[model samples]
Target: MKSSIVAITLMALFTKSFDPQPELINKGNSWNKNPVIAHRGAWKKNNLPENSIASLKEAIRLGCYGSEFDVHMTLDSVLVINHDADFYGLHIAQVTYKELLTKKHPNGENIPTLEEYLKEGIKQKKMKLILEIKPSKNDPERDQKLTDRAVAMVKKLKAKEWVDYISFSYDVLKRILVLDPKANVAYLNGDASLEKLKADGFYGADYHYSVYQKGEWFAKAKELNLTINAWTVNSAEDMKWLLKNKVEFITTNEPELAFETIRAVQSGN
Candidate 1:
């Protein structure tokens, strides 16, 4: 009896050592200087290929608050990073991961898998990984599968805190909340009202820059205490407008210019 008890205790200890609980990996990391989120890493000024690891690194080097990238699951259910449904004329959902990797990005980097991207992202503690899970408009089943797999991968890697999710599909974002209610999820479709978003439990309303201009969304978002973020705002005028309104985040391809604009606006130049 004594020998059996000792063996059981030792086994429990070993298991605990190998299987630790998931916790925030970047718990105390400092907040970024500005609200600029690199639209697809920081590729434009440097001529690097968007969604490539090189661009992600550049965003980190530039000290952007976050770097947004898109995720799509291949036919074999491997999550790869890119901005479009078709990569270099190969339909991503129809091809296997191995086949899709045959073509190199314009910068000569193999299109990065979601795992590879997250690994690089977790290395630093500052920049948040704004992961946009691309939706399959024609196939709802595929979207759910992609959502499940993406969330599972993030959990498996223990990277929950380093990442935030955004999607144009309401179902996909809802599914994310179902899977991880504590997740920082925002809707990207731009049609939902602030009240609707708050009722649906979204972290924020991530809309096109024009969406805010069309209505009283900026004021309503503040009234409802919902976070506000505008996407793809590359022009200086639009950046100034969003910054002046005090939106929480601005997704832009021109992060360097956005920083300059932020300085100018802050200094009342």
Candidate 2:
């Protein structure tokens, strides 16, 4: 657990003391600032189709505090969740939402748009967002446009208090800042230092566990005011240790297991 003072100070930085909305303190009710964000919208083990609404709902049912998903724009301008630039075989960016809707999962479920998922999931609010803005090295401009549209929609929906935007591409994150200065931005793929992050104006840092090798960086993130969230953690031992340190978020493929573990610990059972 984070020291009370540290938690208070960190919360104050991201969320003002007078904001009136409750802090998303992950004591037991909500997710930690560094939460367990389900990868690919919490797909069922059987379906294995990432970014499906079915998986998202199943994650919720399992009491996952938050979920993360990819958001790409359709040619006609809809924010849908899919990892690949193309859906199955077709390039999703070139297709309209209606066109993408025509495609079906192996289980016959429909592909979900970001907006649809957000609206559907907002009622729960337990699952905060870690919206990753995917930019291709080959087509950076396309990434920017997709990011801009997603940022605009998020702002229009007034979900600032609920979502954090992250990306490996620095430009994509910068674009989000331009769209919403207060939008929480975390630099994915931890390679830079706190000094470097502050210089770059990044609010947080997220790196893979293999790369998250520095115990010192955790405190460094706290001191530098860069919120820390690690990714794709699935081990019980690692999860326990990180929780002990109060690492803000734990992105994972096994959200159901994570939540169950969190519940077990919280309930003192």
Q: Best TM-score goes to which candidate?
A: 1
TM-score of each: 0.88, 0.79
lDDT digits (tens) for residues 58-125 of candidate 2: 76766555677888788887788888888877698778888887788887877777777777766676
The lowest-lDDT stretch of 10 consecutive residues in candidate 1 is 17-26
- Residue pairs with colliding backbones in model 1 are none
The superposed Cα distance between candidate 2 and the true structure at residue 43, in angstroms, equals 1.9
Misplaced by over 4 Å in model 2 are 1-34, 45-48, 260-269
Error of 1 at 22 (Å): 23
Q: Give the number of the best model, judged by lDDT.
A: 1
lDDT of 1: 0.86
Error of 1 at 139 (Å): 0.9
